[model samples]
Target: MRGGPYLLLLVAGTLGVGRGLDGQLGSPCHPSGRCNVRFSECQDNICRCSGTGVPSAYNNRCLPVADGLKGYCEENVQCTVPHSHCRRFSKECECVEGYVMARDRSVCLPVSRLGEPCLERAQCKESTECSPSLGVCVCRGISYEYDGKCVTDHISNNWELTVVTVSPAAGSQLLAHNRWLLCIALAALVHAGVR
Candidate 1:
């Protein structure tokens, strides 16, 4: 049999497929369809996809949903359950990093990322935890909050927090400079009074 002429995209939870020797989704086919594959087959003269079967978006073949299978969770989480990610060559429910299942475990939420409200540490983003007192995510231990991100004292990656330090010598010089300016101002005032 020859390859069909259409490409198909299998979406979440839906059997989206159709292909025949020359039959594409919604195309005409004979009662005794010439081609058959796991994802699709001749049915009522129409090609169709069934559970877990996907048709090639680039070819006229039936394939399985691989990692490209999108994770169905809020905040781009890539899993169905909390604190997990998608596995390889297969579709799996996963939550995005820095997210966790809700208190009811009904869904995932982005509790990671500082400043987000969180019920528990598992929900907060990496290196952060939910503050029981403040009731929001904050940096853990030595890390601190900066620019909406949790970072170490020596943070890098173009987000470094600059710390200003002055030695005793620098402090004395600044004080001397201020004193000289004050003396100069007083001298000017005396000169004006004399005039």
Candidate 2:
């Protein structure tokens, strides 16, 4: 009877018919077979997939994980999208340098175009400014000004025209200055004629 019980236990163990002595469930998949797919692993004796899990995404069985920019992931490998990386603390995908999170917070988009609304300079395209007053992207430099609709400039050809409103006293001073210049020019001409 003692031998019989031992033989029964041995057979059960060989066949994997019940829990092991440690009271743990046997793994359904072989150790080598487990984690066969990318970003997949045997967790709690079960094969679990990671990442976005899109069709034919991983190992041809589990869904593919999203890329780092927009997908939720636990590891970098789980991110399948380009220019993306996994954030360990957040367990989410994020964009790399030179990319920005879209307004939807799902995908990484390029910086804003000219005249597009923006919250930060990084959100705008290169050499552009996020207009603080209008909250829109605009060209850099003092030449550009935000009108009601679009950005405008005053430069024409190589010369820049500047219009300024002057008080009465300033206007008279400018007129006198011009007159003095004219008189000086006439004197120079007379002196040249005598020479």
Best by lDDT: 2
| Residues 1-195 of candidate 2: C-alpha lDDT, one tens digit per residue | 679999988896655422222322222433434444445555555445554453242224554565446566766666665666778788778877767876666556556767887876768775577888999888876435444233332222223233579999988897787988656555555544522
- Estimate TM-scores for all models: 0.36, 0.34
Off by over 4 Å in 1: 1-26, 30-39, 66-111, 117-126, 130-136, 142-195
Model 1 agreement with the true structure over 1-195: per-residue lDDT tens digits = 233322222242123223354444444445565335456756686666556555554335555443322443222223324455554454454555555656655566775558878777777766888899998888999888777777764323433233458799986786687988656555555544522
Stretches > 4 Å off in candidate 2: 1-71, 112-122, 125-137, 140-173, 176-195
The lDDT, on a scale of 0 to 1, for candidate 2 is 0.58
Candidate 1 least-lDDT 10 residues: 5-14
